[model samples]
Target chain A: MVSGALLFQSLILGLLLGGLYALLAAGLTLYFGIMRVVMLAHAAFIILSAYLAWWFSSVTGLDPMISLVGSVPLFYGIGYLLHRYLLSRLRPTTMTMMSVLLTFGIALAIEGLLGLVWTGTQRRINLPYGPTSISFLGAQIPVVQIISFGLAALSLGVLYLIMKRTQFGRSLRATIQHGQAAQLVGIDTTKVAGMGFGLGLATAAIGGAALSLQATIYPSLHWHWIGPLMAIIVVGGLGSIPGAAIAALALGTIRVLLEIPMGPTWAQTIFYVALFLTLMLRPQGFFGGRLAQRF
Target chain B: MPNDSEVRTAVAPPGSTAVARLRSLGSGRTGPLVGIVVVIAVLATWPLLAANPYMLSAGVIVLNFAVFATAWNLMGGLTGYVSLGHIAFFGLGSYGTGLAVIHLGINSFVAVLLAAIVVGLISLLVGWAALRVRGASFVIVTIAIVLVLLLVFQSWRSVTGGSSGLVVPRPFPDMLRPEHHRVFFYIFLGLLALVLVSYLVVDRSRLGQALKAIREDEDKAQSLGIPTALLKLAAFGISCFLTAIAGGVYALWFGDLDPIFQFDVVLSSQIALMALLGGVRYLFGPLVGAIIVGSALEYFLLNFGETQFHLVATGLLLVAVVLFAPDGVLALGAALIRRLGPSATSIREMSAADVRAQQDERAAARGAGAGGSVTEEPSERASDD
Candidate 1:
């Protein structure tokens, strides 16, 4: 039942996809880390970005990579404006529950808008070199997969640099660790929160581009993505970046590997299974409490 | 994402005491009773009165969602576990009844009841495992419940009929096609009435009080000798059971079980919002929310033809409710009624000083919200009958 080479291929593909998943989840964790808001709109935004990418490349005749230059900042600004105008106004005591409600609403609106605009028909990007594959340890790896993986890595690296080295990163982390204490120390937690939300949304642009390259896209595809992404966050631990990243890669690999035996339909369940098992045994998440103490 | 050290923002919520006082300038007890009577009369007469089929069917859909929102409130409003996946039971009911009817050749009515009981029993097991984790974990666990079932129902093609879905045989074959809406409307309205009466019973019972205490602060209730876990599980079971019955009835009436629509998280969220929009703390919160939201949805579909504006409308309403009326529209209505209507009832209008005192009390509650002694927070539900 277990073929070695196929398993290796599954592993490689799973890891590549996982890298992008990590990027997608990074924004969710960032928002949660700073504001304790489980932004359900994150998934819908990714779907929105994917459509943006599709429209951009189709109209401009440029690579989707080029589309990201415009989309990333555009999404970031939207997130920034959203936080400044709307989310910032919610009371701290009820922010978590309220944000979940608000974001779900936003997500629905976005989904409906996308459906109206895109007509709910499925579409995928056509990279000239998308179908070509390269030999990796005698297992064929798609060129797009390699490039997307590279993109995800570069984005993640920049994210890590911003989180670890920048003054903003310090403030963000401080707020995540203790918001009141951060404010007491004169950190503009509000501004940081807005920017953090923007940064989180900014990733959606890249994630959308990455997702469009790999999968079939539709207006309601966000629902499919949200479940696995949620599983990743839960297994990774709330508000923990490294934890989410690690969980994404592991679960993503398992999900792809499961495809061989379980078929794509059944394998899609791997995320929920991982989530259920994790919730039963380790509700705080694998990297939540013990591994490298959450920020 | 449980953050205990959240900074209390300086911004006052839009529906603060100031708004309540302004609203109290119009709020009352008899007003809602009168409103309920008007609603019942309107609903009862609508089917009998000369009307087109479209309006009649809309009424049925509204009642369907009304039942869902009310069932969802049994746990979400009362026990404060906002489950986004409660619709999983609804979906299971669809499949369970469909499969039972088609495979076992059982009577449709019997299948409906059987499916509900089976789903309720399943919920107890699921709730036992899920209730172990609270807050965000519980949310994810519930989502996982739906996701896993989606996979099972989707991949298990032999049993569930998969994406192709099962066609449930519609009951009352003797009735004509146009008569379906009229019959189901009465069925759902009667169902709604039963659910409302049950809600009132729970609201007045010891269990309801304990549940409200749990909502206020679960750990405090647990230490005060309330069986927190068991009660949550029980509430979750009942919530699932009722939701399943609604779904089963829907299956029997509609005769389709598409996993996508049945297990929809968006629909579940919408149900959750309906409850929240009405005032989850109040006994009639779900019914009020259901009527408002359900009618609004129907209006959206009617006005914005050939577009998905209804989804956008639902989204906007959810946002507006969370932002401006977090305590719900009924609470605001009650506030207004207290202001304008004569105080024939025992309800007293809250003064500015009383509002200030209440704000301080809520602030103290927030302090207890994060870290507290394992103790009880008394349930003082905002009044409604």
Candidate 2:
């Protein structure tokens, strides 16, 4: 029912879309690895950052991409302080469950605050070149998506360096593997935890800015974004960053590709169905490997 | 009952046992039941006292939510499977009733019953599937279920009426009259009564104890020969059954069934929040939560027009409850009473406080402590701080 070029174009767009998804899901997976908390408010946090990015860019007459210059550091501190003062207190046995409820409450509060301030009006970062398209292998690609994809790759690359090379990253990996065991070796797991959460939120900030470029965002728009991100992480395996990256891109492509024939609603439904099915049949995820037990 | 008595016996002085027993008995299982009965009596006759249409209308909403929360408590409180997607069954139940009413031309009341069965069977399947994964996975799976159902309901426009909404025919033909309000109020109130009695029985029975055991330690419960999985599924099914009935009744009364409006995450969270606010384990916790949430929601909708101040207010309250009073209001109330007033001087007061304080202190200790049971998982990075 469709042309060959359209299918090729969709595949390209899907990978780009998935690039954004990885950036978004990375924060959530990082939190799970460190704290075993699902961070239900992750989507709300992203939307909140998107709003802040929008406001900052509009006020300073800078591109929304530049808003990340402020948003990432700001949310890092917010995420750190939040983990210390509030989330850290929940008992570990129940932390997994309580965090979902508590973060859900936090999500509601964020949505409410955003609704009050933004009035549910959808806003997007309107770059002058946003509407322009380029012929990439004979398929039209929007400039906004391309920029967002490049920025996403840069951010993900930085994330890789931090996770693999830094002292903080080593401690975070240790804590993820074993909290008390890491502590026994003279590591301050609590400090590592706070910083890990901060790092996660920082990624969310970057992801949010990129998201606002290609998609219209509002207070409740988090609801739509959350399901897809959850599907990505769950499909990739809870704590496996590489797995999440692959799953995000694969699922993102499939969703966009499916949209061509099935329409938007069914395409989205298919993603959520995958989330449900994967979670039900294989709680560890398709490729999560030994990293499955972290969450 | 034996556990309660044995614990009280240990805490109180041997000579003061009789007095402690009397005081504690008045406030234990029977005490709450009596209080609930009197509250029901007052509510049952409330329309006669003041036939204000507005109050009756609002009361119906409270009762509807009370049923929803209370039903949710059956699953969450008993099994510790706090579902974030009970909204799926709720929406399904509403659609079931609406469809049954529309197509079969059956009595709306009968349709409600039929919807309950449909939802019950569906939940059995859902619970069977979702119960495979516990904890975070269960929560996410539930969310997925609700979201997927929402997509189906939204896209399958031919049957569901889609975004425009399925217009349900109200069982009562009156328009905004006091009589119309009273009918729903009584119907829900009646359902609440039946639900509470069944819940009270379950709460006091071996089954309830087994469910609580599952909540506290599923591995231990299973080791002890309790069919933890089956019980969880049953509780889930029962919980969804009641929630669906409430949804059906809500549809029949309100005359609309929109996908977004019915299968809402907010409503699901609100109901879960209500159960949390009320004290999930306590028999009347959800009832208490429903009254607070329902009334507060109405107040917000009325005063702050065209906005979401209510959402903000409830969200803050939910956070506070999770942070400070994870046990719920009744537990909080008992603690306060033990701490501040009714001085520990009187023997009766001493016994009551002693009995309650013992339980409260344990709960408090658990609430205050960090992770318990040396569950040193393989990768647990051994950290002191």
Candidate 3:
């Protein structure tokens, strides 16, 4: 039998990791919801933001969190321009295939640029609170993880407000549900699409900042994250933010629990296996309702 | 749109010997056949003319990539199911051959064949499970499969040698000499030729037509009783079999199989990108793409000592190709040729006829199958949207 303390610790850690995963997957699902395009470069953009955070911290001797002031808007503009100019032009019939290829190309370009700028060496943000921990219920938790988890929850909460309370949010939801009807209601879906894409990238800034605090950063680390992020979104039900967030937490917990028995290397396989099994059993996903078209 | 003379020619009254002779001369197959012969002649003599180990080795690598790209195109290009994880089969083949030779004490040729059969069966199973999902989900599943396999191969130290990798025994241990590169180069060339010929044959068969139908509109194809799932599985299996053969040859030629490189997602992307760059619809597209991209990659790696600048170049090229020349560079070349040719209008009309013929064939197929009227709605909706 497992010790209560270890189980509690794993549960806490898993919850925190899941929060971060939710943050990462939120942008991807949002993009998919609005544009019906799988932004494969989503992980690459996160890595780029992480690198920006790392560079900002090193140069200014400030915390990586402070760098979000610059990174968020920068990535937002990039996303805006990407959708406004390039992705918007693709025909809907071929958009799925073309977007994948286009985003994959962009991912490669970003990876190459990152490699050229910083090399491929792994780096992590060395904050003063990195090692500091607090005991709760006789289990120690790292302060950085708590902060990262808090940041994820805070950003997700803000995103929820924006998606629910605002006029733009209503229009975004309308467009996602029924584009033709949304346009008929004067939603200006093209504009909403561009802004929605920007909002997705904006989340990457905070997500990356939180990620640096939790994991080692590198140019190619995006490759490792892509599978898990994809799993979270897919398992949560594509285009459902709440579903993605909850699935992220559940998957995160499952991953940690698997790690206990299967070792760390095999732990990474849990989500991929989950992704496959989920795709096989329910392509519509757990929360995916009418969106599940028969193949 | 046909003129009176054109209609008469097409109708071709019985015993029109002269028109038949003229039509045979103008058949599209002759040009490609001549091009293939010229390409083969040049490749067959390259080793004799250059006679260098480096050149021969480079040729072998290029040809291996050509084969890989062609095999990938069989599924991705023809069937419109972009598999980002095709390297799984490649990695499997590499390990299968290496393990068989090292433990089972089999010859390389037999090992390669064994690996192909093994991979083919695995693909059959994978296709059955994975092909049920369409579009983005299918892509994600493919990627997941590769990731899972990479982890499994990395952790299974007893069989795969883990991350440290496995070394394969040379195919011809007693014939280790300077000419070995030449021999392997020819062997790689032979494999490339085999896949190329297979593609050519399939491109003309009912299977190719079925695959194209699926690519255009899978739902519509299914409505027309095309059995889209079975055909897709067949394409996936054939693709896996051919790619596995290349990987087996690669295992022997490279001499060491590492999971990191063998199961690399980047390699899989490169194969797909090369096929796309060369023009997936064209028979010789992947070969052309592989030669250019593979050579450029080798040159950059040699000069810059492993920087990813080459990848940036490749990415830019991919973006440009997708945006401007989605049909591929060869199509661009053909268009330019037609534009500058003396009989530009005649060439345009001829191409128009070709398109009409293809549409007519598809229409005939649809008419013969179930839910004929349903197919038209999707096509109209696609254009309308």
Candidate 4:
């Protein structure tokens, strides 16, 4: 009963949607891999970027893509400073719990500030081609969705290259493998951690930009974004970048397919039900075979 | 390296009789009893001193949060199972009681109790599966559960009234007179007292030490033949039981309920914040944290309602506390109390263990430096004890 054209269209939508989630989860997994710290404020960062894009578009008539360049580094710096000055000071055992609360506080602060500036209204960052659609294999795809997917893929590819080839990447990997060993080798662990956190925030900026195009952006969007983001990271495996990609794609595909069959409202519940089952049955994740020691 | 360090590194066998003796002593009721009594007494008399409806109303809300936070802390703080989706349990209670009243014409008291039991059983089932996973996975499982509940409550219009939510008639509609502030205030005060008493009873019992041991070192506790799974489930059930009770009370108090508000992730985060701000380690940490944070939000930051002051304050406070005073507001109070009280031997005794542990860790670090390897028995054992 499944048409090839329908399957292709669903997959295209899923892959495009997956890209945004991958971008969002990339920084979270990387941060966890390096520092074993889950920055729960990551969704807040995504929402912040959306707001940032919304502001720039309204005030200066700049596009979201242009806003990305400015917002990414700004968030990176904020994240770096947070890691260095605040998060680094906590005990390792308590780090995750405290981060959850601390980041939630940040989310609250950002949401509050956003409300003050923009009120509680939902906004959309409309690209020029937002309403434009193109036919592909007997199905239609939105231009903005395609652009967002391309942007996400390109950034992720660049990130992968940096991690695999750069000196800083090697140092980051070393630290993830054994922090004490990395520290012994004269690697400035603190500096590396800050940069890693910065990189994570930078990805969040991309995620925010991508999300604004597809969904309605608002101060409360962080609330909606956090659960799904957490689901992706956890379902993907705590610190695996590729795992996040796969998980995002899987979830995205499930979401779209479920939406068609069950309707949007039922599909939303089904998505979480799938996530809950995945987590309960396979804590290490489908691809996270053979549990590895975290640094 | 040194005899002191070696002594510190000595790993006590998990099943050893000595460790068992220590657990009994640590969990003894004598320690937190007086402090609990004084706190309950003060709370009971608070409205008499303030006597203002606004203050009483605020107090009622604060107490409600304290109860919820305390319940959350038992599972999260005590058991190290961080659940971000605790609001799922609260939602169950809210809806459970609301539906019972609206659909079945159940009495408020019976409905509330039933809601707690229902939520508790659900938590037990969820905890059994969710707690199987460690660390971040546990957090995700809880969030998924909450999300599922949120979406269900929103989509299932026949039962839940869709996204707009279901409103229940006030449990005691006659108690709605503005002049009845004293009546509601006393009810809230009683609930708060009941929560505090039950928490203390559990905390001061032997079960508390077992839970703490599991939190501190699950493997070591497991090796000692502690049925960690059962204990964790028990804690999770108790925690949910109390949280559901609070939710039911809140539903009754508000007289209106919505899926969005009842199941909001933000409210769950607020409970976690209250626990952390007060001091997750102490029994009264959530109470102290809720009072300080809640009052500051209500009184001082009302002017900045247009801005993100509350969130900023929460974030800053969390950062500050984690970096500087992870022990929380309760620790500050405890420190003040210690300075006023006569020199207690317990302080010296506790510090001795801490000092030994630190010295051993340093020695282990130095040895690790020389050999490029460390024994699991020494390092892991130190972590365990």
Candidate 5:
């Protein structure tokens, strides 16, 4: 019999971690949805944003949260340019393979650049409320985690709105649903694809800011996150944001809960195992069934 | 049949049989075999020519990677599986050899053989599980295997020595001095030659044709009654066997085993990158890639040990190669020669064009067949029209 308090704490912690994972997967799924390119550099971009946040906070004596205001748009423009100039030129038949290689190369370059600039030393955002905890339903929760969770929720909400309410959203959805039809219907798919990629990167900036608040980060920390992120997006169902978000939560919970019985090191294996099993058993994913035959 | 002959004529061109035969003599089966022999002969006598320990040691390391990359190409290059978890087998072999020599008190050669068989079985299992998925999913599964193995090895401290790693007894301790680098260099060269020979034999066999067919279209190949899954597993097993041998040799030479270095994703990525950089489809691609990448890495590390400039350079090289020269350095070189040299038209280009045309025709025929099937149900409408 597990103690009520331990279960409660695990639940809260899991949800919080999951919330952040959802934000990360949101960007990845969006990219996959629009471009049919698995952006392996997603975690690298997140780490890059974290570094940016760290630098901004250090230089201006401001909270890392403020870095998102500038970083998101900047990342958006970068993503747009990357798609327009480099990614768009690839043949559709070879896009998956080539994109993986291209993104992996980009990830390597970014990691190397980060190492050159800041060295391999781990860095975390030192917040005033870092050590402080809030008493929530008799459980002590870190203030930074609560804030990170809140930020993740807010960004996800905004993403949902952007993906549903706006005209651009409709066009993006149409293009994702049926590229040829959308093209025939006068949707400039190329433009939508570029913007969609930009939106994905903008979310990465937000996720990065949240990640900075949650944990210690280094240049190569992306390696640790890549497997889990891939797992979350894949489990959530490649292009489905809500599905990804839900899967992220479940996986995050499962991961944290596994730590109770299996120890921390083994807890890290849960996502990878989950990813492998999911790919084997249900390659279309939970929300990806409709889109499976098309891909 | 007439169309087939016309296509062949178009691909080969007239009045070029003599030149084609000469080119074949230089590049065909006999050519590469002779080339390999000549290179080996030169390398074998290198110690007599100049017994440079440093150069010989570097050469050994380069050849070791060449063997690994060639093993990887057996599956990745030929079958298009692109497994990123090959380091798992390498690590397993390292540990297997290390454990056998240390605990079982076996000779290094026996340990190597034992490790190869073990890794081959493991590859069969892994290939069965992972190869069910296609494209990116397959890649992800392969990476996951490496990550899982890395964690398992790291945590199983009692057996694997965990993160601190295990130290193995070196084979031939009396001859372990730097002066004996020549012997190890020859050993690595022989291993590389063996790997290349295996690749050649496989590439020439019916099994190779089946593997290539699976690479082209699994569904079509399956429809034609090809045993794709079994062939893939076999290919993966062979690939793993060669890689494990290399790993065993590395274990005996290096005398230490660590999960981080042995099962490193970086090392796996480097192997894949080198294969692609040299040209994966070509038999000699990995060897060329290993020589270039391994030498460049050694030079950079020697000069800039403190910095990760080499990784950046590698990344740039990868991006450039993937984008501009997906067919690889060999193809790029051939293209350049054809464009700039006396030959206005090359056999490679002609054949490439012919292949593309054939593919287009097949696709058109398939489309028409589908149309015919759909129209078959409209017999009454056709009569009314």
Candidate 6:
């Protein structure tokens, strides 16, 4: 007999976890939507941002949110250059092979560099609201969890607005839909691709900022996130933002629920097993059709 | 009915038709078969020439990777699936052998066979589910499958020991080190030979042609009644079976099984690098690539010393190779070698008119490549038509 309060607590935790998942999945979906290149290195970039946040918080007492002010812009520049200068040159056949190798190389480089600088120790940021709690209904919810979910929703809302109302967003969508047609209409595809990449990386920065709250981060955290992140993207349907959010929530809920009965180890396998089954049944994906429209 | 292999063989070289080339390459052809037999004979006797333990150990490593890489090449290079989760098969094999020896008290030979079969069955299941998706989806699914397997190995502590890892004691504790190593080395070499012969047979056979057709155009192959699904599953099973056997050999050589060591991403990435750096389309691509990259990196680390720069150099080398030589170093080096000594090169240069005719022939092949009716283009989810 699970109490209403206990169920409420799980829901709150799932919501918070979903926010973090959405933040990671959004970037991945955006990259896939625009370029059709699965940025396998996206997880590494998130880990990199987390390490940077940890460094800033430790060194200057700057908050994780404040650290993103610098990291997001820096990552934006890096992503743009990486897409334009490095990745854009390859043809599809070569691109498919090179992206994996290149991303693995990038992941290794990030890990090697982080090792040189920070060593293998896991780092965490201490927030003032780290232990604070808020009363909701009959149960107490953590302040960090509330803030995490709120921030994730607020940022996603802004992203939705930008994609819906902005001219750049329209052009970005156009480029994704048909590059040749978009070019014929005088849209600068290269710029659109670069901006799309930048937007993806920026989301990673935001995610990194949010994720450093609950989890201890090391360079190897990249590996841990990659599996779940891919699952989220698949379930949400590749390139669909709303699909990603819904999928993240669904997955997070399943994971949290499974954790209670099956143990964490089995729960981890359950998510992947579910994802594998989902792909087998619906190869085009759950949200792929809606996503095709945005593209 | 002749398939593109025949066309590729026939038109690929002048003074030789596809049938003639196939025959020459030892698939019933006279000339290439004899030459290939001679090469095999020479290679088989090479161990006797290099009797040093150090050399023998190095040879063992080479043979081990050569077998693993060849296994990888089928799914990754030849079939164009590019699996990143191949170490799952390897890990399964290690665990199978280790479990058999410890729990079931099985003989080593029997254990190897069981491991291979287990891995093959697992691969068949994964392929049946995963091959439904195209392109990057297949890659992602394979990786996820491996990740799930890794989690199982880590979490199933009673059976797998979680992070602490499982150890399998050597079956023969009394054997001398060099003698034991030599026997294992010979075993691996024999495995390598069997794998190569199998690869050659498949590569020259009708199924090989069908697999390539599917890779080139799945829809077209499906329309032509090639059974793309079954072919992919078959390829996956075969590839995984060989990889698992190699892993079993690794377990026997090391006398232990560790999840972290056996099923690591590094193993997966290394196989991929080996397959690509050699030449995916070539039969010996992985071996060539592994020997070049592996020996070079080892030399650099050992002789010139080690630093973070070694990793940085490796990363840079990968970038450089992808950017400058998408076709692999073998192709690029052959071109350079030809330019340097065109007169003495094994490949004969065609006359200008012949070259023009060859270009025309290639354009026709390209037309066939592009002209074949299949929705090679990804379906636009929004487009109604």
Top-DockQ candidate index? 3
Q: TM-score, chain A, per candidate?
A: 0.96, 0.96, 0.97, 0.94, 0.97, 0.94
lDDT of 4 by residue, B1-385 (tens): 1322332223233455976657654765334545665776788776787656777777777777888888888887787777778888988898898888887788986898998998999999998888777666666667778777887888889998987778877867776544455566667666665666666656645677788898788889999988988998998899998889888878877777888888877677777777877888877888887887778767755566645556566666656666667777778778988877756667776887787678678867877787746545465665577
Residue B135, model 5, lDDT: 69
Instruction: Give TM per candidate.
Output: 0.86, 0.89, 0.90, 0.86, 0.88, 0.86
If both were scored by DockQ, which would come out higher, candidate 5 or candidate 6? 5
Error of 4 at B255 (Å): 1.0
Error of 3 at B207 (Å): 1.4
Residue B114, candidate 3: how far off, in angstroms? 0.4
Better of 3 and 6 by DockQ: 3
Worst 10 residues of 5 chain B by lDDT: B1-10
Residue runs of model 1 more than 4 Å from their true location after superposition: A290-295, B1-42, B342-385
For residues A1-295, what per-residue lDDT tens digits would candidate 4 score against the true structure? 7788887898888878878888888988887887767677788888888788777887888777789879888988988998887778777876665665566567777777777777878898766878998998788999888988888999899899888999998888788778899999999988988998898899989888877777788777776777777778777777888998898888877777777778877865645665666756776766554442221
iRMS (Å) per candidate: 3.0, 1.7, 1.8, 3.0, 1.9, 3.8
State in Å the error of residue B244, model 3: 0.5
TM-score of chain A of 4: 0.94
Candidate 3's C-alpha runs over 4 A off are A292-295, B1-34, B49-51, B346-385
State the DockQ, from 0 to 1, for candidate 6.
0.33
Per-model DockQ: 0.43, 0.43, 0.50, 0.38, 0.37, 0.33
Per-residue C-alpha lDDT of model 5 across residues B149-242, encoded as one tens digit per residue: 8889999999999989899887888885675677777788888778887787788678889999988788898999999889998999999999
lDDT of 6 by residue, B89-156 (tens): 98899888888878888887789889889878988887888887766667777778788888888878
Q: Report the C-alpha displacement of residue B316, candidate 3, in angstroms.
A: 1.9
Q: Considering summed lDDT, which 10 consecutive residues are worst modelled in model 6 chain B?
A: B375-384
| Residue A21 accuracy (lDDT) in model 3 | 93
lDDT of 1 by residue, B1-385 (tens): 0111111111223456976545543554223334444655577786877378888888788888888998898898888788989889999887888889888899997998999999999999889878877765677667777777877887788887789988888878788756998988888887776565456556545788899898888778989999988888888998899999899888988888888778888788889998999999876788778888888877877788757777778888888998999989889999999777777243444454465567557756865786664222321232221
lDDT of 4 at A3: 80
Steric clash pairs (candidate 5): none
In terms of lDDT, the poorest run of 10 residues in model 3 chain B is B1-10
